[model samples]
Target: MTLLAESPVAVGPPAAPPADRMTRRHKLILTLLLGTQFMLTVDFSILNVALPALGADLGFAKENLQWVATAFALPAAGFTLLFGRFGDLLGRRRLFLTGMTLLAAASLLGGLAQSQEVIIAARVLQGLATAMATPAALSLLTTSFPEGPLRSRALGLNGALLSGGFTAGALFGGVLTDVLTWRWAFLLNLPIALLVLVLAPAVIRESRTPDKVRLDVPGAVTVTAGLLALTYGFTAAGTYGWGDPSALVPLLASAVLLTAFYLIERRAAAPLAPVRILNRPSVKWGNLGGFLAFGMETAVIFMMTLYLQDVLHYSALATGLAFAVPGVAAVVAGLGASRIIGRFGSQATLVGGLVVQAAANVGLLFLGTDRHWFIVVLAVLGIGFYGNVTAIVGFNVTATSGLPDEEQGLATGLTTLTQQIGFTLGIPLLSSIVAAGAAGYGSTTAPALALLGGIRLGVAVDIAVTVLGLVLIAVFLRRAARKNAV
Candidate 1:
């Protein structure tokens, strides 16, 4: 019955030929990993549209309502590096399974929560779970697939699903809130998480660094503290004004803690993050590109959502439908990115994608008052979404393409950290710009028209930021490309 026993080849010297490429089983594993990432990203944006309903139901004060999002963002951003290192020290598969279990529990708690505090706490748990799971998933993905083109293609598809999650969340958030309740947003994760848990153990083989290693507690503490401080400061600056000590103090402390982290890493017996890895141009510049790509894109989505609802008077369902086309386009972009990058090269592909995003933001400048504009806006915005998705794939591939097996988790963690910080910062920074525009518009225009003006101003700022990001990609990625070619 056994093929080996039936064959002429002996068990010792001559052996059966092994498969060199990814098989169906490998593909299934990739699907499971990508699906986990998709679920996490969807949760990130789903809350935006449901905030009002949630606040009213939970009787949350206006200021406290932000905690629902902040709770998730802070720990997710802070603990990612720590968990990523843990994945390398412990078994990545074990950490991944644990994270999913915790995430499922947190989702259930949040879904059933009656008070804002309880939901916020659940979100904090969700953040911690995400922090553990994402880097491990990414690490496993890199190790499972062969490096170079195979890994690049896998990263491309991963990028696509991740981008699709955000777009889908924006669309579905409204639909769910309208049809059912805000709680469904949290509850939806339960089935998906459970499925990943059941399938992961069977499909994913365990991996770790062959050499024994210990966790670097000092590095972990300082880095986590620094990131937390930085995230909190940026988020608070958006809400409470940048001049407030509440914002300024954390920023100052972040500088100190971050510097201490670097010093600790330099002196540690086995460093948490190796300095040589950080020194890589691809890792540094790639993350900057990722930060810009995510930050501007999320800000655009937020502003557009407000414009559609407040100015155009669209229903929640209509808004979701309006975003449907662009969301699909984003997914397509992700799926096709590998082929595009292969033809064009990662550096060229990155620049081209940023250009597309900038041009789309320019298109938003001409937004009209009537419903007829929705078709034009969505189409143009879809083009931008396409560009962002491509850029995301490029950045991911660029960042991890050069790393050794052991540092894969570190590379992936840093990438996700930039993305989370981008999401956290974009809302406040762009919102401040919109607020400034509103103040400048004064009483000359009607309230709706004034809001429109502010939104336009915000889009213009986004255009400028997109251009700046393009410059960064041009300068840094090009250098990295040349270095890698040598």
Candidate 2:
């Protein structure tokens, strides 16, 4: 993909603007694009606090309940690459508007769903909408802003909105579930989606790649099939234990499919992901960091929600309110990210953020059944969230820093793809660890202690994974920096 300033893609390239300074119109455009991103992210976690309520009301079995989250995440993670390239082939403005309309419709369907199958289908539709909108919206932002301070600031704010949306969704989901009905959680998206739909045509301009690129159908099929199989295997492992054929067969198939995907992409006429871009260290390591940043934070939210409601017996509203502090902190960190990156550099910001997150995970080890203990938990989570904000902003900037303008959609697609995959995989993997540990208590430990032990184990897994991410960033990113310097 090549994006030329003088590219033939646009019927009329947007009027040339001052290269460095942002205009009021630019700010409005950013707001509208970010709003769409926020909605997409919100749906990812909106169901977290509502899970229990939703399960009980819908008559979902305990093992089948996680599917509610997975159903949305799977399509979003698996199909984003195809949709991202689609946005470049088709008009981005058209795709963005269509996605919003579908998202609103899905939310309505979810609210009105009578059977579990209907609700799960609605969630899948929502995921498809997200897959379509996010890349288009992000590509629009990168093209609208030049690749400098203006772009860096925009990415930082976008990261902030993304994190804020997830945190806020947890709170809002709880409030709606407690005050009205769990169905309200889905219904709430209607107004926001409708509003974005109404205003989007005026604010967002259309953009696409001028040179026609054929879709890599074989590559797309293999990668999507691979991710689905992989995600399902992990989820099945959580439900049926690692020894079951239910888990092993899918895991093996995923391995074969993903291998085929790589081989196919290597030779495809128009690769779903270009080989050279995937080989860039900055792109590779930056996305790894991003995966950790998104994955662990989501796991934290899921675990905390379960801990507060299942063990501490907090109401949905209370659980949501508890997460507000950390959520606010995440926004602040996002807002300040450009300055932080300017002072410390993207590498430093990312590594430091991961370290802080690791420390916060350690702090979670002290959580007890007492509601008063949440004060400390929320405080520590705020600090961790701040780190997450910095890492998210820094990783995004680094990942796309050297890519050509034509590949902006691909870069952004890779970025969001890693995040969606993280959310899809993290919950089940971490939840399984907690469940396995909890089940092992076997009447030896007190039931309360056993549950707390499981929760602590979950926190420990988060810490270990985060530390591993920090190590990878330190080693790989530093090596890339040295290579570039030389």
Candidate 3:
């Protein structure tokens, strides 16, 4: 449970980048890493605003349009752990470069795609590229900066840029779709990926786990398939009913595959995810906190978007602009996160962040059809964003804090995996709740009123879940402290 304390186990000496001073080279390295983090995060939301335009131009069926987004999400969530292990086994820098190269190719293909099939293929490639890049980039960041204030600062910026990227993607996607074309949304990544490809090799040094362990092929295959099925199941449930075969079949398959993965890992000589690492309280509870933080945040935002567009009758561009203020708040939170963590510690900061987030959700219950409520919505979202960013940084710092140098990749992989899963599943889960709530309204109910009722119900559930997670995490940390004392 020593979530904040350094691990006693040191497989190898930690990387000694000038911990005392920040040099120009260090600045370059930090920029490269943070930039990559921002780009990857943006990919999650960039296509969302453009989906309509992209679908129309490419002849995508209305029912199948979700696949454009899901295609990218499935492989990204599914293969992240495997690629993360590959970073440890092969080379982090090597995997990063390969991912960037793939991203560039995928972006080009997507931008020029003339058909639905081609675009989906491009999206799948983009997903694969993200799977390879995200963990490698994160592990590189952790290794480059020795753990302490420096590492906390780097992670804070990483958290900030991540929130900023998601916000920007929505805003930029709207602008591009309106002014230029949906193709610009895909084309934008080409330059960013190329820049990273050119500069990363020069600035970042290659590092990997020192142990020459064999890859656990069975463990990798099972876990990858399990996660893919899990994500697909949730997505289908969101679109269709939970009891539908599309959702039920995948959910059942995920259960079986994940169980097999667990058993295989137990028996494997070199497990893909070591049981020892998974056993750590920080890794276990920290990731759970991460999952809730991301899942709830995403769900809240999705509902808010629906409220804006459906009830408030705002344009896509206007809705994007509305969220921009919160994005700025998140950036501010990220910039100040290190100071907050330094003063209060990761545990306290995380708890405080969750409290603020819960309070913000409570404020969102005041949302109504009145336009003046937009002011309240904006204010609460800003507060929520600030809390979410700090909590996210706290989760990252706590989860990866005590791990050995050799497992940094694995640790970062787990951190990012929870985030992707949270993002992928959050919307569907909350959307289903909202749908059910809306369906309960009588035929005499107004459409706006029914939608508003559904949104309120969903927000109430989100608040409760956030509170529950906060309590559980607090109890877990408190017990760990008592155990350490004993």
Instruction: At residue 312, give the lDDT of candidate 3.
Output: 92
Model 3 lDDT at residue 392:
87
Residue-level lDDT tens digits of model 3 in 81-130: 88877877777788999999999999999999998889999999999998
- Model 2 clash pairs are 2-406, 3-406
- Candidate 3 residue 68 Cα shift, in angstroms, is 2.0
| lDDT of model number 2 | 0.82
| Distance from true location, Cα of 228 in model 1, Å | 1.4
TM-score between candidate 1 and the true structure: 0.90
Q: Backbone clash tally for model 2? A: 2
Sort by lDDT, best first: what order? 2, 3, 1
TM-score of each: 0.90, 0.94, 0.92
lDDT by residue (1-486, candidate 2, tens digit) is 121222324322464654767778788888888988887887888888988899999899977988898898778877777777677777888888888899999999999999999999999999999888887787777777767788899999988888888888898898888898989888988998888888888877667776776777898899989988888887787777777899899999999999999899878767887666778788888888888888888788888888888878888899999889878998899989999888998878878888887887788888888888777778887998998888899888988887665555557667877767876788877887787777678888877667778889988988998898889878988898799999
Report the candidate with higher TM-score, 1 versus 3. Answer: 3
Better of 2 and 3 by lDDT: 2
Candidate 3, residue 474: how far the Cα is off, in Å: 0.3
Lowest summed lDDT window (length 10), candidate 2 = 1-10
- Give the lowest summed-lDDT range of ten residues in model 3: 1-10
Tens-digit per-residue lDDT, 1-486, candidate 1? 000001111111222234435667667978899999888888878887777788999998866676688888888888888887776667678889999999999999999999877998999999899888877777677666665677777888888887778778888888998999989989999999999989888887776565667778998899999989987887776567677898899999999999999999888887777666678877887777788778888788878877888788787767766777768878899888888888987767767877887887787888878988788778877998999889888888777676665556557667766776676667667876775676567787777777788889989988898898779768876776678789
Shift of residue 147 alpha carbon in model 3, Å: 1.1
- Highest lDDT model number: 2
Model 3 CA RMSD to the hidden true structure, in angstroms? 3.5
